[model samples]
Target: MKLHWSPRSPFVRKVAILLHETGLDAKVERVRSVAAIATPNAAIMVDNPLSQIPTLVLDDGTALYDSPVICEYLDTLHDGPRYFPAAGPARWAALQRQALADGMLAILLIWRQERMKAPGQQLPDWLTAFATKIAASLARLEADAPALANGHDIGHVTIGCLLSYLDYRFADLDWRAGHPALAAWHAAFEQRPSMVATRPDDAQT
Candidate 1:
């Protein structure tokens, strides 16, 4: 398998962490693909029209895309603990958490793009809305930190990546200030071998 990957994308980082956790890192080759919202890469568009990272191409030419789909597919390949619960409330809870984390990532990406524009070109309403959503999401996570300790699932992987991304790109926001519980959870999650190995600053492959 070949993965269209970028060192700095939180979505890609989620998949990378799963690969490490499942002991499948050696099974997939990481291809450094640059996918930007403003500039589409022809290489990635060939497999994923959206030009998204974490696009996985299999040996038979099958392609899996977006981080959630790819992560679930890879989960089936390993015999270890499942990142996706098999059924019942556990599955729904994990999925819901993943959605929340992924949604925040989407917001952060757009917020980042908007902030990158000249200050005068940035829309105040959109900026304020984005900040509001992030704060609410962090509060939700803070309240649910206890549940996060039950198991390491796709939700945990995504939330970990999301928080790390804030640290990486939005340090000025000081996200850890009011969300002490969530911050404490991430402090330990960030030390996992998978997280440490895939740190954006140190990523090479």
Candidate 2:
């Protein structure tokens, strides 16, 4: 398997963390592929029409994409309990949490792009919407942070990766100040071998 990857993307980091956790890192090769709203790479689009990274091409030439799908596929490739829970409430909660984390990433990336674009082109309405969504999401996560037990499943991995991105890109926001439980959980989660090993080394996209 080959993974279209980028160190700077939180979504890609989620997949990388899962691969390490499953002891499946060696089974896949990482190909550095950069994708962004303004800068799209045709090579990645070939495998994933959206031009997203963390696109995993299986040995048989099948493509799995966007972190969540790739992580689920990786989970099935390994023996033992899956990062994705078996059917029932456990599965629903994990999927819900993952979706929440992905929403945060989408808003964050768009905000970052807005910040980078020419000041005149920046949309205040868009910024307001992003801020509203981010605030609500974080508040919800903070209140529910206690549910994040020690399980390193897909939900936990997605949250961990999102927390890292928040710290890296919006450190000035000081999100941890208002969210003690999440702060504590992430502090411990960051020390996991999978997370530690996959930490982003570069600030560049």
Worst 10 residues of 1 by lDDT: 196-205
lDDT: worst 10-residue window of model 2: 196-205
Model 1 per-residue lDDT tens digits across residues 1-205 = 9999888889999999999999999999989999988899999999999988989999998899999999999999999999999999999999999999999999999999999999999999999999999999999999999889888899999999999999999999999998988899999999999999899965454
> What is the C-alpha local distance difference test score of candidate 2?
0.89
Clashing pairs in 2: none
Q: Which is the leading candidate under lDDT?
A: 1
The lDDT, on a scale of 0 to 1, for candidate 1 is: 0.94
What does each candidate score in C-alpha RMSD? Answer: 1.4, 1.5
Candidate 2 Cα misplacement greater than 4 A, ranges: 203-205
> Which residue ranges in model 1 land beyond 4 Å of their true spot?
202-205
TM-score quality measure for candidate 2: 0.95
Q: How well does each candidate superpose onto the true structure, as a TM-score? A: 0.97, 0.95
